[model samples]
Target: MRIVIFSDIHGNAVALEAVLAHIRHETAPDLIIVAGDLVADGPRPAESLAILRALPNTRFVIGNTDYDVVHERDIEYDFTRAQLSAEDLQWLDDLPFAQTVAAAPGRELLVVHANPCDLRAAIKPDHSPAIIRPLLDGVSQEIVAFGHYHVPFVRTVDRYTLVDVASVGFPRDGLLRAVYVTLTFDGANWQIAHHRIAFDAEAVARDYAAVGYPNAERKARKLLEARYRHP
Candidate 1:
């Protein structure tokens, strides 16, 4: 079975659309796994949720931001930012917190928004393996996927594969890009690939501008522009 994993849409429907198009042309996987953070932050959270609901075969688990926006205002979770619309929050509130499945015999997968061991478990990119390994013990899956750091990368330890696909809207790499995972089962082994690529920046930026998030729009554009130059 082949499954695609993605996270942190953060209301950027254009990025989500571009990534969906890429996935259709590429893996054509049987299932799409959403790691969470479906709305808020960018623009048009409601439209983003609509698009997510449109996917034919999608499974999901809420992200930390999703929880923050859903469960309560939680002034600590980027409270300075504007509050999401009642509809957006309601959609997020309706989502599940964590999802678990057995992709194949002896091969299991866990999806979450933040560290599986603890929602508050924070790890820097350069943290030691010892420090990182414990944060992973909380989930009992052969493969554990998560987001929230907004940094894209992967790590493998013991019998577990840690995939941090990053944020499609607020990437640390500085680009309007989407990160995804492709899981292919070959005999007894699981091949997990993390995919990241740029999408339509101007369209999403226009949405942000229209939504009155000029500050966020400017910051997002700068990230994308820097990536364009560097890449």
Candidate 2:
């Protein structure tokens, strides 16, 4: 079975739409797995959720913002403080934390917004074992497909392979264009494929300005200008 894994789509319809368009044109997969962070931080939270609801054979998981909105019941979030409209706030409050155990016949994959270890926290690929070991428990198998940290790469531990599928909203600058992953599991063999799509970053910036998504333009600029936080 061919399963597509993606996440960290923080309401940037421009980016997300581009990714989806590419997916439709380039590949036809059996299922799509959304890691999480379904809304907030961008202009079109409600629109994003609506599109997600429309996807066929797709699984949507919860991100930190999804959990926060569900628990806090606030009209606006800190990331989009004074930016997101009231309707957008409502959209944020409505997403679910998704998981697919016993996934795709024989292969089991954990789908989480950020990390199985800490949903509310931001974790990187090269993290210490001590920090990430606890996050792997309770799940049937590791082979996790996740997002939340915008950068993409694979981290393989002794017992698991954590795949950070990256973010369409926040692409890693100076790298291959932002993308998700295609994992095919035929009984026991697992094959991975990375997919990339092109979007208008300038158009996205313009939308950010028009929607009043807090300091979206500035934050988005920061994400695009910098290579990585540590660098």
lDDT winner among the candidates? 1
Inter-residue clash pairs, candidate 1 = 174-223
- Model 2 steric clash pairs: 61-98, 62-97, 62-98, 117-135
Where in model 1 is the C-alpha error above 4 Å?
71-88, 214-218, 221-231
Tell me how far the alpha carbon of residue 231 in candidate 1 is from the true structure, in angstroms, after superposition.
25
- TM for every model, in the order presented, reads 0.83, 0.83
What tens digits encode model 1's per-residue C-alpha lDDT throughout 77-189?
Answer: 34313445666566666778678768677688887777776554545456678888877765678887787777777777776777776777666666446777787877687
TM-score of 2: 0.83
- Candidate 1 has an lDDT of 0.71
Give a tens-digit lDDT track for model 2, residues 82-135.
Answer: 444565555556555657756455468877887776676655777887777777
